[model samples]
Target: MSVKRPNPAQWLWYAVGGKLPDRYREWVLHDATAPTWLVRHVIRRLVFMAPILAALYLVLAVMMNFDLTIVLVGLGLGVYAGMYYSLIFSTHSVDSRVTRHGYPDQYASQVRKALKQAERDRYNATWRNGGATSR
Candidate 1:
């Protein structure tokens, strides 16, 4: 399938966990399976958080009269806790996202394993097949 980049509106929808149209299937697959997928996912998640965080900052620091520094630190801690769990469930998250876009279950993981097969084979040959470990 050919890769077609989603427009900004589609990307914003995607960032907020909305599914893209069928035309973006290949892009979704590539986005979830590419080498930089982890970083991309994190960035996407963070983008989704931006507006919420801004609203939170306004509520805590402005309306509630909390100290700006304290509010910022509190928000930072909240983000840290969220990111911890997000990373832990990242694989499942990606798989779900890809599936929501109409791909098969675990398609990203399968693609990644396939993409690395040659490199994995080389590593096994070097380490397990007496290339250097046997010495």
Candidate 2:
């Protein structure tokens, strides 16, 4: 059986989905010292906000007291701003907290291990197929 090479689009799709390839998934998910409470806190905040924001948007849209186009634009901007803050500020806050206690370095080391394993696998496959030649 031939090994199926990943296409460029597959790599892009993986990036868009915020995932690494299968070989790295295990290592990435392994958290040696994850602060469970912090993770839960962040998750709860996101879960709580999603429905509240949706309900507010729906109520505003239904009221229709303001101009529909303006309301829609404002709603769009609000959602965009919220997501931007979450992605930028919230993530930095979490990372900083994690790093201050050294969780980030552990995570980075795990990721590097996974990447190295992937590279070794690729090299071995190529060598087995006679792609590597001795000088």
Measure candidate 1: CA RMSD: 2.7
* Candidate no. 2 TM-score: 0.38
lDDT per residue for candidate 2 within 1-135, as digits (tens), equals: 433334556534432333445544332233212335335334534554667667766777776566668777986777677656665554444433334433543453455457778888888889965586787
> lDDT of candidate 1?
0.89
lDDT of each: 0.89, 0.51
Name model 1 segments beyond 4 Å from true.
122-135
* Model 1 worst lDDT run, 10 consecutive residues: 126-135
Q: Residue-wise lDDT of candidate 1 within 33-126, one digit each (tens)?
A: 8999999888988988889899999999999999999999989988898788888888999999999988889999999888889778988898
True-vs-predicted CA distance for residue 61, candidate 2, Å: 2.6
Which residue pairs in model 1 clash with each other?
A: none
Task: Give the candidate number with the greatest lDDT.
Answer: 1
Name the best candidate (by TM-score). Answer: 1
Error of 1 at 62 (Å): 1.7
